[model samples]
Target: MSGHLDAVLARVDAGLEQSLERLYALLRIKSISTDSAYKAECQRAADWIVGELKGIGFAAEAHATPGHPVVWAKGAAQEGPHVLFYAHYDVQPVDPLNLWRSDPFEPTLATDAHGRKIIVARGASDDKGQMMTFIEACRAWQAVTGSLPVTVSLMLEGEEESGGKNLPPFMEAHKTELGAADIALVCDTDMWNRQTPSITTMLRGMVGEEIEITCADKDLHSGMFGNAARNPNQLLAEIIASLRAPDGRVTLPGFYDDVAEVSPEIKAQWQGLGFDEAAYMAQAGLSIPAGEADRSVLEMLWARPTCEINGMIGGYTGDGFKTVIPAKASAKISFRLVSGMVPEKIRDAFRKHVEAMIPADCSVRFTSHGGAPAITVPSDGTYLQQALRGLSDEWGTPAVITGSGGSIPVAGDFKRILGLDTLLIGFAQIDDAIHSPNEKYDLDSYHRGIRSWVRILAALAV
Candidate 1:
């Protein structure tokens, strides 16, 4: 019954140091879920989250999954919407350690080249720091009013960075408890820039596959078979080349059959964002625009579907030339699906296209890795408008609705499994170098992130 907005904001400001200490404790744990050696560490992270939730007066516990433990918690029941908050505890593997200035597990506060203080760690900006924003906000509200403003349930995942294959089934098993929510909040994405706050509404989905082609029983000497033997490597190369047209369209049959055009209103809003195409390409050491020829960089990323060859393997030369035609060749491919595309249909079309390309004498095998559909939040929803107002209030700048090119599988899973719409409200920046060495989360982002959620919670309360 009490709305302690000002007092809650003050509590967040006063308790910033303590919040950092808690986040540092989490950042210190080596909870990389992809590797087998760090399985115990992942469990430790999950347990620590449960403990934190319980300390804050939530009925919280860790549930064992086939892969890693999932931390589930519920707050005091309230009158407003029952919202489910989703975040991941496990981080990406910190490889190429030499590229880092300090230990990846050691959380350090240092000033960046732009003179902003940053928290440097493995999971600083990806999900750990981002997720902690929500937890810390809850703590502040609970301290100020002795209760949260709305009904809250949290589902923290540990296998997000490692493909998160177990989460769909896990959600299926706990749908009654998890699916009772009115909406979902995911804090694992990025803001539009340093000065702006963003709520992501569009998330692209994915379909991953691997194909192998065989033209002979064994590797043949290039000199012996240079003119006679059919080379699988050559065949695979041609197929790969045929995938994309010179005009940057995929050749897969029916690939565009289900694709939908973005509304003109949305397109105008994106164009008004003042996106710096030059800077965007310069970040990746590229100067030319690739992909769809007639689309803007933002359009190519957020709206258009894409087919990319991730990897190709055929022959090898360790120290010198081997001059051998490999009997087999394989390629790893992935498709980023937009709103209207179906995963199975796209995969089937790709397979049929590949099959049509194969010669009668050669055989090909298809291996499917995983698939999920894209998610699009309604642009004119009431809850979305309220959250945007809250963010604008906290930042003193207008908040924007944005879309992401990358796939957060859990967002799609939340939609498909639990039948819930999610607000991908994140406080991370684009250049946080997440999933790479020397990752960092800005102090300003962390401090303002908590305040942003504080305002959002207040605005969402009935």
Candidate 2:
């Protein structure tokens, strides 16, 4: 290890207890963004983060949004590349609180079956703990070297758990303030495995639409006008059925017109990882590949575009049964898009398809929820190399570049609004129970995460 990194690691080791205490203090705040009752706590959490950043010698402040506040901070300016760090201070609601062995807000240190020490709390692994890894690293640097090696801007949001409606506008308003960075470091993703470090390279985009079809002016009794009146539910089902073929491919014309095929190099790398398709299916209580017949599970999840019906409602779905031909039927649909596919184009094509299917007796109305396109960062960037090398130096294994199945909308916003690429790195594990009952962060992950950032900073400085 380099001498500078060794010094930073030493400082982190010396301050490990203090770091845990700070994390415990933040975890105690019930900053649940989805619940209006926790609004004050969210502000308190933002204030606490601001204080922590200020305490570490950064110029920090808590900026209010329409909902919760976002903590913005910056370290001393440097000549090298600047990195904008992003994470969330808010956590998911701790419902079914009876399931926890301890208070969700009162964090405790416990040992797991494998003898790994863990931090048990509400936001232990989701984000609070993960974000602290970077903060603690900065603290270590400030302690040992008296300043950060490279410049950093920290942006912690309190509305991530509530769909980040305020983040885009906030970014738009502060484009000049937030746009002075080459890349972003987002600590909201997970590693591929317990011992393996990963850098996420691709994220799927999302598009949502609500379609309502009206066939009759009013509901008619089945016994009275069942044969004469057309049922909108039947029409809705027919239209939905026509969207996909028996071969599992979407039937919409020009839907896959812009989708790019997965590169052979990526295919080979994914194959070498030896992903277990059966194991993944077993976890979800299934036995079949429900997507494209020829693609592997990894390809289907990481690279393919898909259409799914999120919800549908037509007739009465209440207590009993109503024998009536419903006047209107509605369905909510979403598409997961890959590279080269535009959300607006997909929305236009879908509207066209539905319009062509509508009969003379039926009328249709479409409501479009906004969407963002998919993004794939170059895997061979210098910052990525530095991060991978740093992680390898700390963990004795080269980091793997993987693709995330879910969308991080803020990432797209960063690229679109600010023209910044993001480096998604975090220490959360799959079984950490994020957004579920009994959330916990492994103590080992916390310790090594600080150490990892120490090395990453050193690498980036070089």
Candidate 3:
């Protein structure tokens, strides 16, 4: 197995430049799915990927959705377990063009201040560059073994940057075809750091709610009814302030009931990672960690649940101050949920808490955007061990299992809808600046990323 892997990896090394050329080609297309002006470009990107997959011996095609087209491909069935790979083809819009050092659509290879070679472009690291690593790996494996070690399927989306509404319906319509795989591989996360490779084992979920608190039927003048009239703005501020206690814990009833405590083993592993809380604070221009008591910044971010006010708009203030008391105030609240906490339950608790705080004359209405429960993959699985070993061999460092604070809805969807666990692995670094101006993917990340996938595929084949 080791000798065969070595041969395939060598093939990957020999063809690294060609792999990069292919990535550069994909990065050049302006497949910004959010804007209709780029709709044709999105289709062009999908078509390009379909042709590439076919050339690599996969039966591939593009299927049109209500929005952008989805690209799916399948290689010839092999002896090992089947795996489904997921990535997005669409890139984010490159606004504030003046901030960019070069044209975002033009892929440029340049060195950073630290002397790291980087490919600069929109969507370079977000998914385009990362996804190409998997494809290039498959290309190398086919060149060496004339086939992939395992049966493989590719599902590329065009609306990941936008809201992916078509994906759930499409997956529902083709559940059997996609769910046949033993596991799903998602190349959409960052490595722990520049040198250490990491696998995301847990992803936080989300619950978005918009609450509108209504007081008077119309705006009231403060001079006319300063002390007598009920002010929804004040009421809203009070309700929002009551969400957390002085100790920085959520005050919602049963919010902590289902949230499980971090295990001693996992906590110890995270502690050993040498996480610099002070430095992390400095980057955000802060010196204090404000969250649940006694928890480290990492634990607060990854392991614990959180309630945040995403947006609040009620009264008026434009150019000058308006002394009128607004009739209603509204706020958009989002909850970052952890495993073992149900989204609906959290939503209900939040609504209950808000209703309890409303005065007799005031009325509160809640609007739910959406909610998804958290997902956690078992660390002891055979496939996980294979991936960890493969990554360790490629990077010469033990792969760290980490939890992500941000939620990838598709990861949870795979488990809930298809009964399949997903392995989230990627070569992106923290400073990739995805979705921001001057986005980039390290050249080393692109090269070693392909090699790592090669090793993982060889191991999974066993």
**Best-matching candidate per TM-score:** 3
Q: Which pairs clash in the backbone of model 3? A: none
Cand. 2 TM to true fold? 0.97
Instruction: Put down candidate 1 lDDT per residue, 1-462, tens digits, no spaces.
Output: 335799999999999999999999999999999999999999999999999999998999899989999899999899989889999999999999999999999999999999999999999998899999999999999988999999999999999999787888989999999999999999988888888899999989899999999998999999989879889889999999999999899889889998889999999889878899999999899999999898888999999999999999997647888999899999999999999899999999999999999999999999998998999999998788889999999888899989889898888888898999999998888789999999999999999999999999888884
Root-mean-square deviation of every model: 1.3, 1.4, 1.0
lDDT of every predicted structure (CA atoms): 0.92, 0.91, 0.93
* TM-score for candidate 3, residues paired by index: 0.98
TM-score of each: 0.97, 0.97, 0.98
Model 3 lDDT vs. the true structure? 0.93
Q: By TM-score, how accurate is candidate 1?
A: 0.97
Per residue, candidate 3 scores C-alpha lDDT tens digits across 272-315 of 89999999999999999998888899999888999999999988
Query: What lDDT does candidate 2 reach at residue 277?
Result: 93
- For residues 1-462, write the lDDT of model 2, one tens digit per residue: 246678889889988999999999999999999999999999999999998899989999999889999889999898788999999999999989888989999999998888889999999998999999999999999888888888989989999999889999999999998999888999998888888888898999999999999998999999998888889999999999988888888988898999989888877878877689999999999989887787788998999999999999998899989998999999999999987899999999899999999999889999988798898888779998899899888888777888987899989999999999988998888889998878999987899898888888888877
**Among these predicted structures, which one has the highest lDDT?**
3
In candidate 2, position 91 carries an lDDT of 96
